[model samples]
Target chain A: MALTDFSAEEQIAAVVAGETSSVELVAAHLARVEHDEWNSFLAVDRERALARAKEIDGLATRPPLAGVPIAIKDALSTRDLVTTAGSKMLEGFRPIYTATCVARLEAAGAVIIGKTNMDEFAMGSSTENSAYGPTLNPWDLTRVPGGSSGGSASSVAARQVPWSLGSDTGGSIRQPAALCGIVGMKPTYGAISRYGLIAFASSLDQVGPFARTVRDAALLLSHMVGRDPMDATSLEWTEPIRVPSATRLDGVRVGVIEELMSDGIEPGVRAACQSTIDMVEALGGTVVPIALPHAGYGLATYYLIAPAEASANLARFDGIRYGHRTADADVLLEHYERTRAEGFGPEVKRRIMLGTFALSSGYYDAYYGQAQRVRTLIMRDFAEAFAQVDVVASPTSPSTAFRLGERTADPLSMYLSDICTIPISLAGLPSLSIPCGLSEGLPVGLQLAGPAFSENRLLEVAHALELAIGFDDAPQGVGV
Target chain B: MIDDAITRHVARLARLGLTEDEVVRMQHELSAILEYVDQVQGLELADIVPTTHAIPLSNVLREDVPTPSVSAELALREGPNVTADGFTVPRMG
Candidate 1:
């Protein structure tokens, strides 16, 4: 098998065991990056990646991820790399500081080959929202890979890089990971530092890893997570996430969220989820029906809360500092207005308007405030469910990869794409999307979530279930 | 439907310069989304505390001591028209 085809853990092991040089491994992966064929990468500086790999090859002693190649979503700053966050507003904006997650990964000896594409400001559920272009699903080129982490997810799925980092505000990581047929995780809120990530909704955004296997995803996450003094919300994780040695899930309680499964789910997705439950039972894990009564309102609450936060977070894009400056502005206020008006796209504008109205003087209490209360209720529902079960199961996305331009016309239809994953983001919990099996030649993800800081337990259940399901990660012999 | 006046007002608040064509479009879009999201107002849970952050956190305060940091030139490198160690912006008339 090609070095690019090996799991990230296996690639790292090959380098550590002197089976393959870092340069060779990186070169093999770079060859698979396909020169803008997938629209997955914003920048693929082969020269820089090769030079970095050579540096790792010459090291006196090997580092943990010595010679491993990974891609980062453009939302995270990378010091010298231009991070557009998939928006033309900040087209050539290069940050001087690197995010805490990127810094930690680099310090542990990983080579960043490129920055992946994403939806503008992490707003939309499809990479079609990207100003540059949408990232195609590697599984089927006509379909979208999902967003705002589509590029990152597709890159990992295509084996351009064995693993990558992506941020999930509301299912960006998990949905794309599901659509693209790979393992993606959204760790507990504040479990990983958000210091350098371009802020969307501060409370909802989380950076996590995408990998070919759950263990590899866990390994990459373990390297990236820790408290950052820069991000006050970041917490020091006390528990060690170990690669589970046991292959069977014994006495694990998997709570199936009834609300998520009932309405608007595709039949193939439902069949795959039911099969997952049966497989869990086969592996000694019991399934319990969980009722999250308030989950029906998660979409409504999220639309208000996320956009309200986004309006505030995105207000920094005025022409004065960085980002696009309009040529027609005569004064400061015109500059701010015209710059933002011209720079932001339609979806962004709609969201800004929605958020501005919601937070406006007379409407704040009825919308944003009420949404926060509903958020509290949703969190309480999860708290009640977690009390009975160690982990909860749902479909990461309602369906597999949708065709490009399928949901773009109607904003509400596009928003519904994230129905299954949005509630988990609202409550600020750890969740993972691992491929269960194929549904009509497409991958379907079975989502597993746990309460705050229960990633180790979630991983334990996921890893064991993964082995039992024996999912074929390949999509019609597509990549590496 | 959300009125044109309200839609324009919200657009102004957002500092977004929408064209008249866009104003009409945004009015319809905003009305539909707002109508949908207005479901939150139906809940009678005023007593429930709002969650600002996912995890409960106590503020960590420290001495406001100056630390070594990035140089002004490097920090403003991405800013438009950096001159004399500061950003150049249009003057308010």
Candidate 2:
């Protein structure tokens, strides 16, 4: 059997059964990374990856993820590995400690293949904001792989690696996974620890997994979730989540958000989502119309809250500490000013300015304060909706992936691309994006969301739908 | 729309120096974004409280025990300029 044919779980099983060696599996993926046609990885750690794989091959009892090759988003710090976060500010900076999630994955014998690219400081919707170039979509090279986890999604779509880790603050993981035709899950906030992740809207940011199948994502999440002493907000799992084994969706209540299906959504995307709802109903499930009245304000509110927190969180990048510094300045103030101006991209600067203005003395009550109040209303809407249904469904994006330069010209239009996913982030709910069907020859993502800490149930529902859809379509010329 | 003066002022507050062109562009863009987000101003928030976090937690304290931490050398490894035991920076005015 070919190396690329096995799922992540199967790869682990093969190594345990002595059918394949970890070295061979790692080498096959490393070769793909070296010849990466999609520009997915920013830095390849071939030597270290092979060394780890060799070590795993020598072991008698294999771990859960032994010998599986996984890609990581550069936002997560990998000890002794270059983590650029797709910005020139920290272009060659290497962290001394690996992130908790990464450390756990490594402990499980998953070989870290390389670091993937992302939007500069995870600030933009499209990967075009990266200091490095944007990642091209594997489906259509002329189109964009969504961001800020574009590289992670594209790599998985191209089958460079079975799965990759991506961070989602506001739809970064889901939108890109939707565009790339893969599975992406943003677990309930604090479900995964954020110890080694470079901050990007800390309250909303959560590391997630991207894979070709929902089961693969679930396996990754099983290792990623757990309490961490390093991250104060991390939640401890009281008991192991029981993965539902039932194949049918009998007695399952799926809530279709009435507001999300209306205006701004493409006809094809709308039709595809409706068909998924029909599929659910036909599979012994009930579909009900749910209301999220305050969801319309989610994008606007997120722009304020995320950037406001980001403005404070990102203040540490001044020239005094780590990251890029300006040499032409003699005074401390000039050093800071020039360093930040020279380091950050346009989108980052825009957010900093917007956030600073919103939090300023005179405007705090109007912008940041009001955005917080609206955030409450948005969460309450979700709480009320969850009371009526077990899971909420919507299109992961309003439309399929657009051309590479399609939304780059206008930031507002780019922000609108995340309209469907942003509301879930604001409410800190668990949401997964799965390929429903083809729309205009491109894949459409059906988003399944549930109340906080409902990851197991959410995944179960998604897995059932995934089996029904049978979306095993891979990008052309990939994994053949 | 916010004026260029406010945009420049905000940039200064953010410790980012914007060029003339960037300031002008920021003025236009920030105005557009603010106008869009102004939709929140229409809500009736008389009794609604602000939500800073979805999960309610307060003062997450840990045991008062010292643990091994990243060495100063490793921490300063990524600094642009390093001194004998610390990071070097521009002199204050």
Candidate 3:
């Protein structure tokens, strides 16, 4: 059987049953990643990975995820691998320590197969902004995998890894998962530690998982969720969530956000959402249409708040520290110019400029402060909607994955692709994207969002829907 | 509310040296986006508290423990220019 054919749980079972060793599993995955042409990885540290696998294989006591292979998003720091953040700025910069999330995964006995590609500094929705190259959707090589977590999402969707980690600033995890046709979850903002994640917009940045199934996503999430001393903003939720069994969706009330559906949804995308809604209702769950008044301006609020925070968080990369430095500079001003000019990509530079402009002295009140007030309104809207329903359902993106360079020329159009998923992210709620159906042979996702810290509940609903609407396991090339 | 003057000032704060043409381009683009965002001012939010983060967060801090780092020699290895004890660079003034 193909290694990717097994779910994350089954892989662990294989390790536990003495059918294989951790090194063998790691070797198999590395081989698959090499032969696979998705360009999902930026750096694959085979020697270090095989060495770690041998060490884990010697363990007498197996952890829950022993020997399972997973990919790390390039944005996080890993001592064994170069933490590039998909930009030339940190090209050779090796972090002294591992990210808390990566450390936690390592402790749980999972193997770090490689570092995946992303938009430079996690700035774009598609991976086209990577200084290296774009990550193509495994389903359709001509098309983009959803991004800046595109590499992580596409790897799992292509059956290259059982599960992988991705960071979400504004729908980075869920958006790509939808585009790649896999299960992805962005936990409540502070639920996972952000210690080693290179800050894009610190306030909104979060680490999440992309998996082949809801249960697998939850299993990885449970391992990664906890407060860490390194990240001051991390939260401590004392209650341990039990993974819901197959029958947990009874009497659940799911609210469909009215504004998201009417805005820019394509015809096939709408049908898939309605099909999921019908499945929810058939299973004795109630589905209702609800209005989020502030959601109409969600994109606007995100641009302001995220960039303002980014402008502050990114100031530390000004060449005085340990990142890319320029040559032939006799003076400080010349050094700053050469370093940044060579380091950052067009998208990152654009955002830094826009954020700097927004937070400048005279414009601060009108742009940044006004954006915050509107954020309050958006949060209130979610609060009111949750009062009437247990979860909200929608298409993860307005349309399926587009071709590479399709929207690269227009940055605004690319940013608008995140419209539907950005609101839930802004509210710091838990959301999951599961493969619902196909549109024009490309995969679309059904986005299920629940109240804060309700990851288990959200996964339970996704599990129920997965059973209702089965997904095709056929690789795109085989049938085509 | 934003114009070429504001763009120049913001660029300076960002430490970006933009030419006159780049300044004009950014001014028009930022102006268009800011005008769209101005719609947020329509809401009266006197009663609401502004939120900086989505979740209520508590700072997780470790005890101030001294940790060992790489020796200065190794730290400055990647530096283009190195001093006897540290990294050397262009003069600040």
Candidates in descending TM-score order? 2, 1, 3
The sequence of per-residue lDDT tens digits that candidate 3 reaches over residues B9-93 is 8877887656677678777767776776677878787777888888875554679988787777666655545677876668875
List candidate 3 stretches off by more than 4 Å.
A478-480, B19-24, B58-80
Candidate order by decreasing lDDT: 2, 1, 3
CA displacement after TM-score superposition, residue A262 of candidate 1 (Å): 1.3
Model 3, docking class: medium
Ranking by DockQ: 2, 1, 3
Query: Candidate 2's residue-wise lDDT over A1-480, tens digit each?
Result: 368756787887788888888899999888888998788999999999999999888887777788799999999999889998999889788888899999999998789999998999888777889998998888988888899999999998887899999999999999999988999999989988999999989889999999988889998888889889999998887655544455678999999999999988999999988988899977889999999999999999999999999998889989776788998798998999999999899999889999999999899999999999999999999999989999999999999989988888788999999999999999999999999988877889999999998888888899889888988658777776
Isolated chain B TM-score per model: 0.84, 0.92, 0.78
Comparing 2 with 3 on lDDT, the higher-scoring candidate is 2
Which stretches in model 1 have alpha-carbon errors above 4 Å?
Answer: B62-65
TM-score of candidate 3 versus the correct structure, residues matched by position = 0.96
Candidate 2 residue pairs in backbone clash: none
Q: What is the lDDT of residue A125 in candidate 1?
A: 88
lDDT value, residue A374 of candidate 2: 94
Per-model TM-score on C-alpha atoms: 0.98, 0.98, 0.96
Candidate 3 lDDT over A393-477, as tens digits, reads: 9889999999889998767789888998889888999898999999888888989999998877888888888878888745565
